[model samples]
Target: MAMSSTCAQLCLRCRGFLGSKTSTRLHYIQSHHWRIWTANSKSLSNGLFTNGSFTSTQTRQRLKQHMCYYNNLTVKYLTTEAKENKNADDTVRSTDGANLPQMPNTTALSIPENMNSLDLDAFNEPSALEEISDEEAVTIPFPTIPPSSTSLRDYVGKSETLTNLVQLGVDLWKLEQRPNVGSMLLRLDFSTDVAPRLLFLKNIGVEDSRLGYIISHNPFILTEELENLQTRVNYLVSKKFSTETVASMVSKAPYLLNFDVKRLDNRLGFYQHQLKLSASNTRNIIARLPRLLCGSLEPVKENLKVYEIELGFKLNEIQHMVIAVPKMLTAKKQKLTRIFDFLHNTMKVPHHLITKFPQVFNTNLLRLKERHLFLEYLGKAQYDPTLPNFISLDRLVSLPDETFCTEMALATLEDLYLFQKTL
Candidate 1:
């Protein structure tokens, strides 16, 4: 304990007041062979205290209180420089000039990975951090020097922050959407930025499982102002969405709050007005497909033309179909056209019938054709209610093969299966 404490005091006094951790590290790295640093987490504050940079006990105490996160942080300093004296005694002189076992010299040196402000030319000479004695050897009781390793924890200084993020199911790499993640983690104050955001997310009712997806995809959430975020959430609630519903929207579309509220309001208005939908219908559409706000309006507008002009659906029918299945608006242009052609041309379905069962088009083309062919073979492909044994377009596409055959087709599952196989 005494030797380690002595080493800590010596390192703090010799190296601590050199500005940021980056400059301090560069100074040591250039003379890495001579400087064996302390691993104490609290060494920086201690260094400032000893060097008279922080003179007042109250000022020092406040600094300590603010930067106390360094407490209990064990930092490993690794340096490698090829040894010149292989036959030299395995010893270094301690701060008190005691003989200590020398740290092994090697071929490569590593700057602390999280040090963000490195000036490689910070130290042109080794006198800044003087070696007390080069000829004598000393040893101090210190934690076993860890074997060489690179870890997420090395870059992310505080283990608890990482633990909480991992616990929340966040992928550390996903947080790299922001540049310089290692530096950010080292400098990020958890109390001010990270914790409050996490708590705010929870208080807003984002689910635990969804937390990972939301945060990993949108790391800016950690840095966004709490008041601004609250305003966005409030704006959503003001639009008649419940707090719980807003959480669902935010989780699914993590960037939803990233949009301006006026733009958001304009978007909501666009969807409602463009579709000629009721305000309630527009809200329902957003509830069902939160990503609706994120996509470009061009494709949506184009498809509206496609439905009314090319597909020959009346404007009113288009609105009704979109309300029934809002995703229909976002459906692939070619596939939607193909499905509409098949329903209107091949199956002789009326425009109103297609509107009545908009979800029928949601099924793939092959399934629709295969089932229709199978029904045709069985002589049961009737759609008119007045005709005998009518088959709804929905039941045709929706039911499992066996259920479709037994209930709708009045044929065996084997028949349907065999027909499908032939196709």
Candidate 2:
């Protein structure tokens, strides 16, 4: 009876020691049970408790039941906490919005047959962001959308500015009939802004229909200031570009009117002073190479250097060559080198003589090669260095196909045709 009383007292003390909180209760129970078991294990094993109301087996069984109950409680509490944490994580992911980076598609992560055998480390280098600076991080700008009208009629109804512009010379009916008119009108702004500029262009000899064509081709010209357009025209006139030539150039390359006067002056200077071309020749060059009016003269300058330094031509020789065939100045360096190599090293033509007949360089490389080789095969390639027939380079290259076959090659057309086919 005393032993039973003592066991009951111990059970009450153990229960009291464990707190009511579910989280800490399991921990306390585990620790306390271990201590109690370890301290009393030897006595229990020796059968000292045999005479007690509770046998050692019964005591161990009771302790085991308590431990199992606490363990089950702990598991249930942990499962409830895990469920709450998972809910929080899901809420965070959904609320992140655009801040969260996009994940790659699961399909994209599937390994290809060849890649499956390769070591993953080879492709798993650190992200470029780590190496780059904060300033270097690319800023993705929000797209900008220009204000748009639903339709021409709707646009005219809403903006009085656009209605007035249509009244002035912009053929709104024609513009409305065309596709993408909303975008075109938006770019042109209110017609009131463009009318004065159109009048300015008309005043400067751009005919009514011609002005329409210019506007159609390059509507942005309608936004240019009258004074700026007049300045470009005046600068062209000062360079001796005839009004007709200026009008033609402007009509064909309307962007020419947009260039700054200083830039126009610099290009004119390059043509007259550096290139040694007369005003008339400059106009002709511009007609042929329209881009010359706005593009950098650096390319022409570079070609001149190539002719002077690499090909060993004097300045006068280069000036004459450019005046004769301005397109030669724009030819690729490799092309010029190939022609020079053929004429100088292969044909044994002197550099001075080649410069004298720059037209020789304008001939097709294959034609030049075939004709020269055919002449050589016929044993008529060699000639006196001083005579007119003395390798008449221009005549050799510039002759038409029929003339070359009958006169120069001294062969019938059929024979030349057959020879070319074989080549």
Candidate 3:
């Protein structure tokens, strides 16, 4: 190989790594190749002598009296060719290291004195991927996300049964109602407990993508008996709900199938007879709000009573309110009562107007109160849209807070905030 002139110089700098630059050089004498240096300072003179390139006569005299320290302290090396000219007594080689000619533009490296010869040669790490094993990618143990990311993911790494479910995209966060589902999942056999339900749902026309979210939202659907689930579907069909409507209802509220067949029959009967909802209207309401059947029938009955007896709404107005917002049928009786009392006595909103725009039930009572009070504060509390300075009830709650403050309230958000704080 050829040699480069800029070699073996940088190792002499011996500063930090930043101060060091990459260099191509290697230098070695026969035996001093990896030798350690020691001082021969058994005897010492009283003082040390120095000079500034010996420009003055005193510097030359002092240099002449003492040793040539600069030349003595500097290391001197013989090149490969020069070693042949040197006496054999000055050159030596150890049998342990390989004998190689001193080459230029190469780095000199030696194993440390304490390191074993085979240790350096044998230290190799396996090159396999650490995040996931190939076998896990294919089978009942998928790579898991952190527990903090979603509730059941941590269990996936440890529970073989859960790994496949997570792989299928079941979002465990929606299972907030089942706090111990992670441990409970370990006991279920996915092939028997879950796979049949998945097939049944798909056969019933539930979309494939919604399977995971529906199962997570209502975990009981998976554990529910296949026979029972099919019976509920059949009952809906018996009631003239289409196959598409049944599947749509399941997707919207998975717990709809979890209800007992008799209880479901009673719910369907209540809508038909007691509430006097027409067959088409009942179907429309169920198709829109499927979870209306999830809870017991008592709350629905009580809210209907509150709308009629407690709030003094007529039969047609109640039916119109139900048709306008199906959710009001299942809303808490107390909440319905509070909204009615405030709108009736305080805001003086007419009962028929409340029935026509029953979506006002969706707004928070506190917000309704604050807006009404703020409008009164500004002396613009007129609600009847035909009257002067009328504010639309729809815009009051439907508009965003900032938009409502600017357009309807005619006040800044700061004023509303201060007014709410006082309330």
lDDT of each: 0.71, 0.66, 0.67
* Cα lDDT over the full model 1: 0.71
Candidates 1 and 3 compared by lDDT, better number:
1
What are the TM-scores, per candidate, against the unseen true structure? 0.61, 0.50, 0.58
Per-residue CA lDDT of model 3 for 341-408, tens digit only, reads 89889999998778768889988998888888988988888888678888878777788878888887
All models, RMSD in angstroms: 21.3, 19.8, 15.0
lDDT (Cα, tens digit) per residue for candidate 1, span 68-162: 22221212232211142222333333235566445345324344455433344445445745665644324534433223324454443345566
Candidate 2 per-residue lDDT over residues 258-278, each given as its tens digit: 888988777776777877777
What lDDT score is found at residue 69 in candidate 3?
24
Output candidate 3 Cα RMSD.
Answer: 15.0
Q: Name the regions of candidate 2 deviating beyond 4 angstroms.
A: 1-186, 189-219, 276-290, 382-385, 388-391
| Model 1 vs. true fold: TM | 0.61
RMSD of 2: 19.8
Candidate 3 is scored at a TM of: 0.58
